[model samples]
Target: MCMKHRKLLTAGIGLLLTVILIALVRLVDAAPIGAQGTSIGLSHLNQFVFDLFGVNMLWYNITDWLGVAAVLTGFVFAVTGLVQLIKRRSLLKVDREILALGGLYIVVIGLYLFFENVIINYRPIIMPDNTSPEASFPSSHTMLVCVIMGSAAMLINRYIRNKPLNRILRAVCYVIIGVTVVGRLIAGVHWFTDILGGILISVTLLSLYEEVISHGK
Candidate 1:
C-alpha cells in the first residue's frame, strides 16, 4: 500500500480500538444497576443527553426513513457494480477496489444485524405501547446512514470526474449524516454513547475501505 493509504488504515484502526475501549467502559459503568438504580450511561452522559433533547417522534420517523433511503442509495451503487461485472464477463474486469467496497457493505450490514440481536445498550425510553425494551446502543440508523451515504460519496468521488457534482454528492452525504446523528439524539430513541459509537465505528470502517481501495486502484 501507498504511504497515504497506510497512514489512513493505521488511523482507522486506532479509532476502532478507541471505540472498543469506550464500549467496554459503557458496559462496565453504564449498565443498569438494579430496578431501583439509575441507568448510568457513558459515565452518566446519557442523562445529560436526555435533558438536552427530550424526545420527538417526528424527527425519529423522518430520520428512520432517511436511513432507508441511504441504504437504497448504497444498493444502487452495488447494482451498478454488479452490472459492470456481468457486462465485462470476467471478475478480473471488475474494479477490484469497488469489489472490496461491496464486501465492506456486507460486513457493515452483518455487524448491524449482530449488534441488534445481541443487545448491548438498551434504549433510554421504553416504547409507549410495547413492554419489550429497545436496543439503543450503537444506533443502527446512525451507522447505516454513515456507512451507506459515506460509502456512496466515496464511490461518487472515485467515478465522477465533474468537480462540482463530486462536491455536491459529498455535501449531500455530509448533510444526511449530520441530520441523522442530530435527529436520532433529539428523538431520544438512543443514548448519547450509542450515537457516538455508531459514528466512530462507521467512520473507522469507511477509512479502512478507502485505504484498501486506494491501494488496489
Candidate 2:
C-alpha cells in the first residue's frame, strides 16, 4: 500500500479500537464498582487491577506533574509560533509544523472536553478536593502526556539541528510518556480500560499528526 493509505489504515484501526473499548465498557461486566458506588464497565477486571496496586497518591502526583510539564512544552511551541507571527506580521509566516501542532492540540482539548461531559466512567477514587467522582474515561493525563510528548518526539528532529540535543529531547519525551502511562495505571485512580482508551485515542491522533507533518515535507 502507499504511504497515505498506510497512514489512514493505522488511524482507522486506532479509532476502531477506541470505539470497541467504549462499547465494551458500556455493555460488558458493568457494575457499581467505582468510587461512591458509581457504575464502571468491566468491573471485575477494573476491581482486580485496583486491588493489586491500591491507591498511591505519590504516583498520581508525579504523573500529574509530568502532565503539567507536557502542557508547558506545548505552550513553549505555541509561544514560538506567536513570536514568529509577530515578527513576520503574518500568521502564514509561522512554521507549518507549529501550525499543525496547534491544530492537534486544539483537537486534543476538544476531545478532553467531550469526554468530561459525556461521562463514560467515574474515577476509581474521589480526588482530594472533589466531593464526587470525576470523569475518568480515557485517563486525560495519560492521553495528554502521550499526545503532546509523542508528537514532540516525532517533530524534534525537524526543529533542532543539533544531533545530540535532538536525541536528548526525544529520549526525554519517550521517558515522560512511558512514566505517565505506567504511573497513571498504578495510581489507582482510573480503570484499566480508561488507560487503554487514552492510549488508543493518542495513537489515532498521533497517526493523523504524523501524516500531516509528513505531507508538508
Candidate 3:
C-alpha cells in the first residue's frame, strides 16, 4: 500500500480501537449501576439538549428538515453522477469518483445496518422499554451525514479557489456534522457511546477511501 493509504488505514484503526476500548470500559462500569443510575445522569442532559433543540425553534426546524435533506442530498448526488455517466465528459472523472465512493458507502452502510438490526444488540440506556430495537451503537445517521457532507465540502473546497466561498462551505460541513452529533445525543436515539463508535467507523472508512481509492485514480 501507498504511504497515504497506509496512514489512513492506521489512523482509522487507531480511532476504532480507541472507541471500542473506551466503550468496553464504560459498559463494564455501567452494568453494575443499572438503569436508575443511567437515567438520573441522562435526565439532566436531556433537559439541556431539549432546550437547545427548542431554542428559537431553530434546532427543532433543523431536526425536522434533516431526514428529508439527507435523503435528497444522497439522491441528488447519485442522479448527478448517473446523468454525467450517460453524457461522459467534463463530469466523467467526477462521475467515476462518485460511483466508486457510492459503492463503498453502500457497503459500509449495509454493514452498519446489519450490525444494528441483526447482530449487535444493545438497548438504549435512556429508554430501555423501547421495543423497536434501535441500534444504540454508532449513530449511523450522524456518521453518514458527517462523512457525506464533510467529504463533499472538502472536495468542493479544493476546486474553488475563492477563500470566502471555500471557508463558508467547509464551515457549513462542520456545522452539519456538529449539529447531527448533538441532535443524536440530545434526542436520546443513541447512547453517547453509540455516537462515538459511529464517528470512529465512518471516519476510518472514509479515510481509507480517500487515501487508497482516491490515490489510485
Best by TM-score: 2
RMSD to truth, every model: 2.8, 1.1, 5.5
Residue-wise C-alpha lDDT for candidate 1, range 1-217, written one tens digit per residue = 8677675976577586746756674566665731234354464567777778888999999898888889788778778878988999887888866688788888888988888887666777766787667776678889889988887788888888999989998899889999999999899888777788888788788787777777744
Q: How does candidate 2 fare on TM-score?
A: 0.96
Ranking by lDDT: 2, 1, 3
Q: Candidate 3's residue-wise lDDT over 1-217, tens digit each? A: 8788576767668576845644463444333222233321233333344445432334434654674565566676688777776777665466545775687569667866776665333434434355344444556676777667756664665556999988887787677778877776666555555566667766776666566446655
User: Which lDDT tens digits does candidate 2 get at residues 1-217?
Assistant: 9898788799999999999999999999999989999999999999999999999999999999999999999988889999999999998888888899999999999999999999899999999989999999999999999999999998797888999999999999999999999999999989899999999999999999989888945
Query: Who is ahead in lDDT, 1 or 2?
Result: 2
How many angstroms is residue 127 displaced in model 1 relative to the true structure, after the best TM-score fit? 3.2
Q: What is the clash tally of candidate 2?
A: 0
Instruction: List clashing residue pairs in candidate 2.
Output: none
* Alpha-carbon lDDT, every model: 0.78, 0.93, 0.59
Q: Stretches of candidate 1 above 4 Å error? A: 1-28, 31-40
Model 2 — which ten-residue stretch has the worst lDDT?
208-217
Residue 18 in candidate 3, Cα distance off native in Å? 6.5
Better of 1 and 3 by TM-score: 1
